[model samples]
Every structure is written in structure tokens, then in C-alpha cells.
Target: MSESRDRRAQFGWAFYDWANSAFATTVVAGFFPIFFKSFWSSGHPAETSTLQLGVGSALASLVVLVLAPLLGAVADRSRRKKPWLALATGLSVAATAGLFFVGEGQWLFALTLFVIASAAFFLAMVFYDSLIVDVATPADYDRVSALGYGLGYLGGGLLLAVNVAMTLWPEMFGLADRAAAVRWSFLSVAVWWALFALPVFLWVKEERDADTPSAGQAMREGVSELRRTARRIFDEKPVLTFLIAYWLYIDGVHTIIRMAVDFGLNLGFGETSLITALLLVQFIGFPAAVTFGWLASRWDTKKAIYLGLAVYAAVTAWGYFLAYEWQFYVMAMVIGLVQGGVQSLSRSYFARLIPEGRAGEYFGIYNMMGKFAAVIGPLLVGVTAAATGSARLSILSVLILFVAGGWLLTRVDARAAPSPE
Candidate 1:
């Protein structure tokens, strides 16, 4: 573990998050929502457009819930996580680049691209995250996890800034159409992702292959293994407590991402501001995440997470009061501070609790809980928005889950967590 820390291979491994986040920022959070509404909208009224996004998110979450665990298990067993990482990265990059061809009135095409891109991104993360347990010692887990998230925020923030500049100033990129600038933004993410991602494959050596089993055989066994691990861990009080807590909070977090754009759009922020603000969170997240990461090591990591949730709850409350664009900036900053920190540390903490040998199988079911909870967040927001006809009020709905999750997180016994071998 000491040898792995600060080694180029381990650093390279973390950089994969940096590499892939360009797509996550520019495509997922930034301009793609505009592309969906402007190009994809078939004049099917507000509810339908919202539903389409909801359904796509739900589908992506469903796929991720199933695929991430299997991939994690297979990678751990096979000792060959990189190939899967590379494949997922390639698929994501390709899908982001392909967004250029999806023009106005192409909502279906845009949704398809989103489905592919999101699935690839989330799938890649499972294997990437599992690598952390393998790479970092338990003590250094906090720092390693922090660095990965910090780099991701920096990378994602940088690319989104460039895309924002391009969108706001199309002539500089030699494109006359502003929409063309948007298209170019997608291309940039692809290039940035593909180029930056190469370092890991070059530097980070992969684990020994689990075994050479036929793909079909692995799938059958993986599913069986998943169920066994789920049951095994369910009986453990600490594991069950943490899983339930994680499920509840992560649902609110995922909902915020899926709904932010739509919510902003409904609030009448232009595509440029909403996307740029999204980029702001990425940059804001960079330093804040690092600070929170450092602080986690000194204080209780779960307490730090609880603090983040409190901030999120406050942000949700503030969102209801925001009537102008200026408040959005303030709230985006609030979001920046806790978002990455909460998520990164939550993952790092969870990794501490898993047995080393079955990390793959366990994390798979973990992904399922994360993904399954995702369905409720957006669905609730959509239902509430439609029922109340108030996007501002809709933001408040997320507060309940975060507060509840925070309370439950207190139930997790951190001392009992497994230490690195």
C-alpha cells in the first residue's frame, strides 16, 4: 500500500476520473439538456419532455444497477479491470463525439446517445472505484479517494469552461453557428476524454486475471455470487445500516444532477448560464473536495459527510427562495463544496467496510442499491413538479431524503469496518 501511494501507476489510475469527467460535465450536465429540449423537443408539451428525460435516466440507472456489479465482480476475479475500463471509456467517448450528428428535432437520437454515454460512464466507474481498494492501503484511502475526486473536478471544470467559452463565442472556434459551437463542445469532450485516459493504461498495471471463464459462464455465476454476497452482508448490522443510509442519500444526490438542468430550464435560465453554472460547480468542487478530503482524515469521515448533507439541505431550502440568476451562483457554490466530498468519501468509507476477496461481488449489489434508489428521486421530483406547478417548491422535496439519510448515517459503526490487508 505504501508503495502504491504516490506511484505513477496509482496516480494514473485516479486520473481516469479526470479523463472521463469531460464528458460528464460538458455532455451530461452542461449543453446536452439544451440539445434535448431545443433539438429533441417535438412540441410534446412540458410534461412529456420531462418524462422523456426521466424515463431515460430511469433506464440508464436500471442498466447501471445490473451491469456495474457484474463488471466489478468479473474484473476483480479475472484480475483484468483495465480492458473493461478501456472499453467503457471508448464507448462513452464515441457516444459523446457522435452527438455532433444529432441535430434539431432529434430528441430520440439525443436520448439514445445519452443512454449510451451515461451507461458507459457509470459502468466505467464501478471498475475504476474497485481499483481503489486494490491500489490504496486503508489508511491512504482517504487521500487517494480525495485526489481522484479533486482531479475529476479540476478536469471536468476545465473542459466545461472551454465548452462554455465556445458556446458563448462561436466565431473563435471558426464556427458560425452557435449550435455548431455546442456540437464542437461534444467533440472536445470526446478528444479530452480519449487523450487524458491513455495515461492509466500506459502506467497502471492491472491485477492478475481472475480466471478464464466463458462470458456466459461468468454471467451465470456472477448473478449467483451477487445474491450470496447480498445475503451474507445483510445479516451484518453495520453493513446493512450503511447500505440503507447510502441508498437514501445517494438517491437525493443523483436526483439533483438529473433534475438541475430541467429545473433551471423551467426557471428560464438560458442554456449558456445553466451550463456555465454547472461548470462552476465542477471548479468549485475541485478545491472544496480537497479541503473536505483532508478534513475527513482529521475528523470523522461520516461526520464530514453529515455536514455535507446539511449543506445540501440548506441549499435545497435556499433554492426555494432564489428568484434571480444571482442566487443560482451562490447556490452553485454551496453545491460545489459538498457534492464531490460527500460522494468521494462515501465511496471510500464504504470500500473500508467490504471484505477484500469479494469486493467485486459486494460492490455490485452496492451499485444496485445506489441505482435503484435513483429511480425514486427523479420520479418524485417530476410528480411533485407536475402536481404543484412550482419548480422552486420542487427543489425543496429533495431535502427530506438528505436529512433522513444523514440521521441514518449516524447508525453506521465506523470502527467495525474492515481494514486493508
Candidate 2:
């Protein structure tokens, strides 16, 4: 019965990845840029629309960076991670659903909704990630994290395929045209995201603190706890070094994910190839992500992550030389091999380092570091593209981040350091 319950809980937790990935694949990655340029910001130059999108993304990341640690600290003190997750998820769903109503020539309205939805998505992930400690043991962390990411790829991919079909063959779906189909696709994402996310709130239960403090007192203690967590993180050299390494490489990884489709389009690769490439990533990533987990169990976690970083460095270099659709497809395949492994191992590895009671606070910093990378990645890519008048050169510029991140990763002592929090 205990084993059965654990299995159910684990699946429930993993489904959140399935649920939320609809947003990641369909909205943010697959369709949003194309929709923004072709419809919402129609008549605007592609470069202008791309810069605007970057600004909106940066704004969303800034909000998450400011709020992640504070809200995480409060949730830690209140023992209310699930509740906060629910609230953020709700906001995200609502904002995503609202996107269906954003008509053409309303780029400002579109940006507003996108920013709100993006912020909510990032905020909810902090709570969800902290729950990793509650659901699985250290021994299982790598496998379980990989499972979550694998399922995410599957779920996100499935939905994106449907959305792509809708865009390509709207009349078959009883829609008026591609525009209407895209709008409905946005609505479907909201439903899919909300429906799949329900299992986490329903089936997974988190242990609560026995002592209840007043709201004000909890806030005060949370601030103090935040300080302690920060000190603990810095004082522990291994984790700090890993985070610095993660910040740099993950920035490059994220930059690629965010800009890949846009970069391809800018290079005159038509929309079909870009969409096809997106689907390819989702399917390929699922198995590759799981393979990384198996590798981690047999090998050192740090070593596995280093291997992922090395692949990403190569992927960036390949991106600089991409001149054909086949090459883009090849790049996507390589990305699938390493993306999930690196991210999953990093999360599970960090979970092993943090103290038991402060997972929320510590994961807050983890998420913040991720969001901070969002800010830097887009800015770096956008500025480089703007300055060079060539997106290919911009791809080359990202190699610096991977190199620096890989070098710093070597500095982190492979021994797991105990958290003093």
C-alpha cells in the first residue's frame, strides 16, 4: 500500500509537468512569436516585434526575480506551498485563456496578458519544484525528476501537435480560418493546463508545520529565514559554485529555446519547418530526458550534467553554422539529448544540498536564478542580433556563456556539502 501510494503521488506530481508544459510548448515557444508577428503585431517589422517580445519576457522575469524569494520564504514559514501553487496556476490559466480574446493590432494588450501569464507560470514552478523533496527520496530524485521532464515533453508535444494541426487545417476542426483556430488553440491550452494540473492539488499532500504563527510574525521570520538561507547558500561553496555555473549555461540553453523559432524564421526558413522542428524536439526530448536519469543513477550527477553542458556548447556552435532545414532539424535533435538531463539533474542535485525545512526558500533562489537568466539570455541575444545585423552571429555569441559556465562548473567540488540552515 505504501509503495502504491508513492507511485500514485509521484505520477500526480509529474503530471503538473505535463499540464504546465502546454504553455511552454504551445504558447511561449511554438505559436506566440508567429502569431504576434503575423496577426497581433501585423504590419510591424519582424525585428521590432521580436524586440518587443524580448522586453515583455524580460519584464516578466524581473517580476519573478523580485518576488520569488520573498514569496518562497513566506510559503516556507506558512507551510502553504500547495495553496500558493494553486493561486499562481489559477492566474496563469486565466491569463492564458484571456489570450484567445486578444485581437489583431492589440500588441500592447497581448504583451500585458503574456507578461501576466509568464509571471504566473514561473511563480507556480517555484512551489512545484520545492515539492520534489516532499514526494521522492534522494536516491530516487534523479529518476523522478527525469520522469517529470519526460512527461512534460510528451504532454507539451502532444498539445503542440494538435495546435499545429489546427493552424494548418482549421476547416477540418470546424473553425473559420487559421486565425480563429489559433485563438481556440490558446483556449485549449488553458483547459489542458488547468485540467492536468488538478492531480497535483488533488492527490499530492505536503506535510505541514505544527506550529502556527501569526501572519505578521511569519512574515518577519520569513525575512530572517531568507537571510539565513542566503548566507547558508553562499557559505556552502559547492552549491554556490554550482549555481553560478548553472546560471551561465542555463542562460545559453534558455536563449536557444526562446529564440530558435524566431532565428529560423529570420533566416527565411518557412513556418512549416519551424513548427515541424518544434514537434521533433518534444518527441525526441522525452526519451532522451529519461536516458539521462538512468545515466545519473549509474554515474556521478555532476558528471552527467557536465556532459549535458558539453553537448549544449556544441549545439550553440552548430547553430552558428546552420544554413539548411536539415541542419536545423539536426540541432533540435541534439538539444533533445541534453536539455532535460541537465535541467532535471540540476534540480535534483540542488534538492539534495538544501536543508529539509527550507526547501521552499532555497528553491526560491534556484527559480530566481533561472528567471534572472531569462532576463540576460534574451537581452544578450537581442542586443547581439541588433548590433551585428545577423542572428547567426548572435548564436555564436552564446558560446561564451557555455564556456564560462562549463569552466565554473569544474570549480564546484563534486562532494555534496551539507546545508547549515
Candidate 3:
């Protein structure tokens, strides 16, 4: 690839984050939980709806956890990451669009679509993350990865703001009511995701090697590769430790993202306040993510991550005593400062630890760990809320994950070379 083409590819690749993050912002973190409880599971008790949402999220993570590593290996061997990414994106778009048609009091059906959309969304990321190696050299990984996340925040935030406006004043948008407006938001996310996703497929070229195998052979060899990668992860202490740390802390992050609205609802905060706070996170996250990338370059990547984790720990602790709507906004601002930073830096940092020419397989494991953590985090909050019947107590469960994960991160040697095959 020429120099100009490489920059285009990087931009195209980063834009996928811009594309799919609409689903993250508009559907997953923004309106879905509010709508699911108030609209879909209208009569259910608060705790019941929380548990249902948690189970749905866990189920989605479980599906991706099982499939990501193997699918990644097959894509790596077949040299077809883009096609696999396309398939996942298409499925996710369809599933998200399907949500627009789900009727009131159809919580089960709504949850089903959400699970499909969420799973497909996560699976697409496996290929998306792996493709970083094709877009930039090792020296540029931190900047390029952060660029994608920064764009994600900007793009997702922009659409979410529009969606929020539609809901706040349904009449202005020609909608019948707030419920109708929320449903339309789901449709908008699907269209936005599909429309922006096109650029990546058109402009970003997947790198191929001469040794790429036939479909049948790839499937057979992919399973063999999975085993080797698993063993390799174990033999490499730094990679193993970093993954374990990521698993622990990221669980808290995922839990917080998925459950924050539910937590506020349980504490009697209004829907408008909760949604507004989420928008705050997105806008603030845009500049913060880009700044973290620069900080990692000038300071140290691991230190930057540690700063994010420390703030998260404080946020988790403060959440237990959250009283007023204003405090929630304050927490959102604090979280916005570090949310994208922690997540983007983790990706770039891990990219440094993995072997070349096998990003698909390695990032598969990386995403698998993330999904596995997702499984645990939501379930922990759900089970705690259900058993104890205390939303405040449940929020405290995440503090341990951040603390433990941060401690374990100290064991990792970020500068260590990838372990040889």
C-alpha cells in the first residue's frame, strides 16, 4: 500500500467505530434499558426487569465467548477478516432494526432481539480490532486505536443527541409519543450503522499472506490454531497476566455501562435525567479519548490506564451513596474522562504484546476475555440486586474488580516482546 492509501485505510478502518457505536450509544447504553423496563416489561417489578436485562446481556456475551476465538482463527487462516466482519455487522444491523417492530408488553421478544444484536455487535469487534495491524505499523498503534475510539465517541454522541431530541419532543419529529420516538431511534441506529459501515468494507484492505488456506482446510487448521494460541497465552506470563487483569477490571466497566441507567431508575431518578447523563459521557469522551492516546505516548500507557482505573474505583464507591440527580451527572462527567481512555489504551497496549501475523487469533482471545468478563459483571449485579433487594448495595460489587485488576496489572511487563511460537 502507498502512504496515502495507508492513511485512507486507517481512516476507513477507524470510521467503523464511528458507525457501530451508534448502536452502543443509542440502543445498548441509552434507550434500551429505559424502554425495556418502562415499555416492554411495564408491569414487572424493578428487580425482575433488572435481572432479565442482566441475563440477556450475559447470554449475548456467552454466545460471543464461545464463538469469537474459533471464528477469529478461521478468519486468520482463511485470510478473510473483512468478510467475517461484514457478516457480523449485517446481522447486528438486522437485529437492531428488528427492535423497532417489537410491540408493547413484549419484553421477551425485545430481549431476544437485543441479545442477537449485542452478540453480533461484539463479534464484529473481534475482526475490527484485529485489522489494526493492517492499517498501521506498531509505532502508530496507540494513536490509530485511539483515533478510532475518539471517532466512535463523536459519531455515537452525535446520533444519540439527535435521538434524545426526538424523544424529548416527539411532536417536533412527527412521532405520536415518546415511545414511538424511542422505537424510531432504534431504526435510526440500524440505518446509521449500515450506512457508515460501508466505508470500511470499501476502503480498508485486509492483508493476506501466500499461505492462506482453502475453506475446508482453514476450518480444520483453525481449530488446531486455537489450541496453539491457548497454550501460547499460558506460556507467556505477561500476556496471561494482562488478560487476567483486563478480565477483572473490564468486567466492572462493562457492568457500569450496561447497568447505570437501571441503577438510577431503581433509585427513583427520572428517565430524562439518566439519558441526559449518558449523552454527557459521550461528548466528554471524544476529547478525553484522544488526549489519553497522547498521554500514553508521552507518559506511559500502563500509567495512563492506572489513572483511569483509580477514577473508576472512586466512582464505584461514590455510586453507593448517590442521592440526587446532580450527583449522577457529576459521576457521568468523571466517568467520561476515563471511560474511553481506559478502553482504547487497553487495546493498543495489548496489540503490543501479541505476535505479528496472528492478530485475528490473538484478538479473538482478547475479546473472548472481555466477553467472559461481561458475563460475570452483569450477572453479579443482577444476582446481588435480586438476592439483597438493594440497588445501592449492588453497585458496590464492582469496586473489587477495579481494585483487583489494577493490582494485577502491575505484574505485566508492557515492554516485553511477544513470546515466539
lDDT of all predictions: 0.80, 0.87, 0.90
> Which wins on TM-score, candidate 1 or candidate 3?
3
Error of 1 at 100 (Å): 2.3
Clashing pairs in 2: none
Instruction: Give one clash count per candidate, in the order shown.
Output: 8, 0, 0
Best-to-worst lDDT order: 3, 2, 1
Worst 10 residues of 3 by lDDT: 371-380
> Candidate 3: which stretches are off by over 4 Å?
40-55, 105-108, 256-263, 374-397
Q: Which stretches of candidate 1 lie over 4 Å from their true place?
A: 1-6, 40-51, 103-107, 209-220, 256-267, 373-397, 418-421
Error of 3 at 142 (Å): 1.0
Worst 10 residues of 1 by lDDT: 1-10
Q: C-alpha displacement of 386 in model 2, angstroms? A: 9.7
The sequence of per-residue lDDT tens digits that candidate 1 reaches over residues 160-262 is: 8888888778998899877888888888889999998987888776556546666677667677776666677766677788988899898888777656656
> RMSD of model 1, in Å?
3.1
**What lDDT tens digits, residue by residue, belong to model 3 across residues 1-421?**
8999999998999999999999999998789988999999999999999999989988998899899999899888899999999999999999999999999999999999999999999999999999998888877887888889999999999999999999989999999999999999999999999999988999898878888789999999899999998987888888899999999999889787766666677769887787788889999999999999899888988999999999998888898888887888898899999999999999999998888778888899999988766557777777888999997788788887898899999999967858545
- Winner by lDDT between candidate 2 and candidate 1: 2
